[model samples]
Target: MRRRDLLLLIGATAGATAMYQAMTRLGFAAESPYRGPITLEGDPKGASVIILGAGLAGMTAAYELARAGYKVQILEYNTRPGGRNWTIRGGDTYTELGGAAQQCLFDDGLYLNPGPWRIPYHHHAILDYCRRFGVALEPFIQLNHNAYLHATEAFGGRPQRIREIKADFEGAIAELLAKATRKGALDEAVSKEDQEILLEALRAQGGLDKDFRYKAGDDAADFRGYARDPGGGLAAAPSNGEPIGLHDLLTSRLWRGLQNFALYDFQTTMFQPVGGMGRIGEAFARQIPKVIRYGAKVTAIQQDDHGVAVVFEDLHGGGSVEEATADWCVCALPLSILSQIDVNVSAPMKAAIDAVPYASVVKTGLQFRRRFWEEDEQIFGGISYTNLPIRQISYPSTGFNAAGKGVLLGGYTWGGPNSYELTAMSPADRIKVALDCGAQIHPQYASEFETGISVAWHRVPFTLGCAGEWTDETRRQHYGNLCQIDGRIVLAGEHASYIPAWQEGAILSALDAITRLHKRILASR
Candidate 1:
């Protein structure tokens, strides 16, 4: 099915779509018992594994480690687990507060915003997990999210019509895409990730038409056409265990075969979980056997002959010094937070994580007594590309008995007046900043909430920012350097994976760390 139709089917389901997509693509239809837990239970003590965070990555590693028969304990600083895939609820529905962002765009609009922002069934890890779990799949959706470019300079609350900047915007992007398919290769089966990445590289270097806009327009379809590449839904290469590089396969054809769709928003799309994205996290948590040490901030990790000693602080109360000695440890804390961990790792590991550049994103949730957007005459939910302080907003709480209107209005806010100053602001001030800036997106934003809380990861004690990666080669190498030193200190986080900042990355990295730890545990015997 087209990505848009898939989205509609998903949104129609409410919020359970993400997990469904993950499962379906991975081929999980009936591979395992859907209602039961699949664990890796090994023996304790022989290879006690201490997981440093309860985020997806940490928890994933824990589940895999546990089923392997290793005693596992997960330590986290948050009062709750799920790390970035956090969910906040009002009525019956809960919206992801941290990492997972949902959308309302449709099939062809997979690359569009407020939906499948850019999930192509290309990542082997995402597909594999989905199949292993038995979740179903759906495509994307397309509502009013048809946008080609977006101007950060401020247009208005609603997205500008495509006719507004036809010349400099759509014209250039269309011409550019045509050039990719024209390159001569890509006709044969190749990994989508490599193809898109190569095309993007060429597009950026002026390989195509250079008549591009200095700034993106409301219709990000033009610029992000290159950005909305579905992940090369692919399997790992036999030789390297990495997805096959497009450079290896499609290098001969170039971009001569691609096509551009009409609904072109650059935002992420996702089928509204029949329930919510939160369901996916809950699923993983249920499957995993873990004791999350909430509010227990890891301070240090020291390694020696026997194993590793993890030093931590119980941030929930009076400070106390506690240490857990484990045969191995997996550090699944955020890279930003990891940098703050009191223990000093090797200089290279520290430098690598420290060097990753994180984009500051503000996620603010506004609770409304009713569903204002649903009442609006313009369209249904799946609001995208608004010219406001908020990047995108969807009525996430549309269907729920307890939530009343059950409205979830959220946005991705970046760079604006006092954007930098937010770091020093108080909670009240930050909320005001989000609300004040948010007001530009919709007046309801300024005056809507009875009361709301804005969780700025930038201001979060340990987490500094959102999904961005390091460009420096040295920094990238640092991620690999951080592993269990002889099965004692493992590192797992968004930063630890090739695809950093995404939920899939967190789980994938954890799996890697867990696999290694599991091997060590078994080998020791």
Candidate 2:
């Protein structure tokens, strides 16, 4: 079966968490390979290079190349930096491809990151940049035991606490294993001594009683939580919560949500900028403000052995035609847009550009009158998974336990029929759908919702989609050509790296591309 079909099967049968695992295993995600700051040993001798797009990749190239004594200028389509590393704040406005515009009404200090938000500890390149630029970082909570996992048909559509499901599932599995071991079921696979040790370990792991049973008692309550409080005064005695039977737990399929917390990409120590994800882009733009020519949309790219010239329309200057010439070029534009622009390159490079498609995703941000998830539900941060078309709801990582209005990532859906369906609707309808679906998980959504804004990445005017959606077959066929320097121009972005859909990939791809370009330039001299 095709990769998408296989993933759909996994998602349908197993769940989103399982589908993500399969993606990672199939090379859809990978760790960054940044060791340290790159040093360009050779001099560029004032060689001029024009970079396309002022996103992370473009700015990273400009920063490094300018530091290496190269004259770098960047042309960006948007009037601001950070292509998809964006944040929507109060008073900010956005216009999609179909001319639907939205003016954000979030309160001060509240914003929504429609694109990349969290940075894993292992993404050293972005973290190094954040450190170098002095962008304040705070922990991004990916898993909160108090958060929820809901299946429409499970438990009469009632949501269950993550901690409850996790503890009960583990306890149930452990009890069964212990029973089998005690009945000599593992005698063929293990020695009697090892079997005894395993039984002891299982009891501790499952919070089972001395009788080797998982029951409603103090032992099980230790891991699964107590039904009543253990207070300092009278009536302080705690009561154990009943463990869900193994059959019910299995049938509920809530265990599918447990794997997400264990995924390497989303493990603890994840971080976001103190204010918003846009801070990283703002920091980069601050370093080289003069080099960026915002609102310049590339129309055509042509090159020869001597140098390269680019044709563009200055959207800020009455859409006048303009040209930029340089000795070299690092085109960091997204493939979704880049493929459509007239660019002179090898047939193979052009084919590579057209081969990769971008992923469709929709994210909706809702502002509420109060932080109900924190005030009422006590869910400070983290995500709640569901089988609904919205896929998941991620609570804000910042502004924990604050009093006034708050914004929640009310709905997030990856590439699927749901994403396309959401993308087809107007922004208003998307927000309404988000509110309706989210109300099922948190009934307070209907009452507390103030305003909301939704972004269907495919409808975005600039990127036209989310990140590059590469398959194993496409990567095998076109990834090499896409990265190769076609004459004086080379490509760099998340699309050119193994770790697609991440800032680290863009930075690393730029670093690698420019490093090779510098070497080639030095060799020519």
Candidate 3:
């Protein structure tokens, strides 16, 4: 959505320095001093920190650490900065192709407040970022009906409970999944037995496990055998697969660890920025020294007793690998994407990176010629649906003037689809699917789309998906890998920060790691 639309929404609706920040700047978001290489303030010779990736997580960490006198070098895979937290511009106006949406969310009180944009609570790095930069968060705008799922076709009475929503899923085997969870997680402790049963069910459904960890890719197929087969519903398939994989069936609670903020859990939600989500990333980007590099990809990472060396590949056109070394390095890149990179880290670090997988998200952004669908009532955040692939159709340009007359609509699909598939699809096909869904709600919008494009994060090479997924094995293994490698390779980013997968989580992770590294550096002095 564009800017002018927001002004028409409600005229409508609407923090301090945070403890983690070094110094507070009024109105400006605080940038944490702990983002990059470890540095002690009193030293004449500064420390060198090689940061991988220039996304929000990497940028914030570099910003914080550099301010405290750490000389930093950032290597990014994308042609531009901002990894999953992406911003796209057609001409002058822009919209995010990927990332957590939020801005200016910390205050001088060191107290955190809700901002115009809503980020997942699990993301500790974001709060840490706000504290460092001193951006204050306002209250999250109350959404309508907490629309878990809304459609014009009318599904029926409201769910008696959240489980009912689960009951109504399109996957006929959903009930079997719920039943399997009970029989698998608790009823039967035999892990291997549970795996087989789940696989049978998933195979019966159109499901495929991208990671071959548990021989999961074997027998991956379409959902035909058990499409609500009552007999199959009652009987459990033989439980067997990789013991370390997700149960064929599971509960939504698994995601709480990732989002914690209940953002994805609720179906219908439209968040407008108090300022704008872009401002948040921009704020973090600003605090770092102007030396930050863009379009640099790290091809090889090697470390020795002296320091760590990194190689970069230019993303724009001509290619030359550049190398730089640092006393310490904070790797803020997403593990799901970074796993493929040739980094000479230990087996455990590599395994850890491979362990926490991300969810593939296909977001379709549509811009209209005019207020095509905003008739009857001036609608901003439109209906969320069960009938469509896209969860919600929102008009983000609800307020503001200078931003202009624009509308943004999207179709979000998670891991249910295949990897590397969407990237191969044409932009027209992606937009057609999104608009088709939107038309289901307001039948009037079937053909009025102006220009549309889709974001297939799974194919982004540098970011396999939009955010973290709630796989059984993934949840089990995320936390143990948070520490640095032999006290040198510090980890930062939404993935490394223990915040699941939100921008705030990225900031907090950077702060925590930086603070810890900061202490380590000071102690050495």
Candidates 2 and 3, the one with greater lDDT = 2
In terms of lDDT, model 1 sits at 0.53
TM-scores for all predictions: 0.61, 0.94, 0.61
Rate residue 109 of model 1 by lDDT. Answer: 11
- Candidate 2 — which pairs collide? none
lDDT of 3 by residue, 392-498 (tens): 55444344232233555456555564323554565556667777767665555665566665667665556766665546566566555545644567777767643
Worst 10 residues of 2 by lDDT: 26-35
User: How many residue pairs clash in model 2?
Assistant: 0
Give one digit per residue, the lDDT tens place, for model 2 in 232-271: 7788898888999999999999899888899988999899
Off by over 4 Å in 1: 1-45, 91-143, 146-269, 272-276, 342-345, 386-388, 395-410, 415-418, 427-449, 483-487, 520-525
Ranking by lDDT: 2, 3, 1
Q: What ordering of candidates by TM-score runs from best to worst?
A: 2, 3, 1
**What stretches of model 3 exceed 4 Å from their correct place?**
1-45, 92-117, 120-142, 145-276, 400-404, 418-424, 470-472
lDDT by residue (407-509, candidate 1, tens digit) is 4445555655444455445545655665665455446654456544454556544466665466667544665676444336667877777566666667767
Best by TM-score: 2
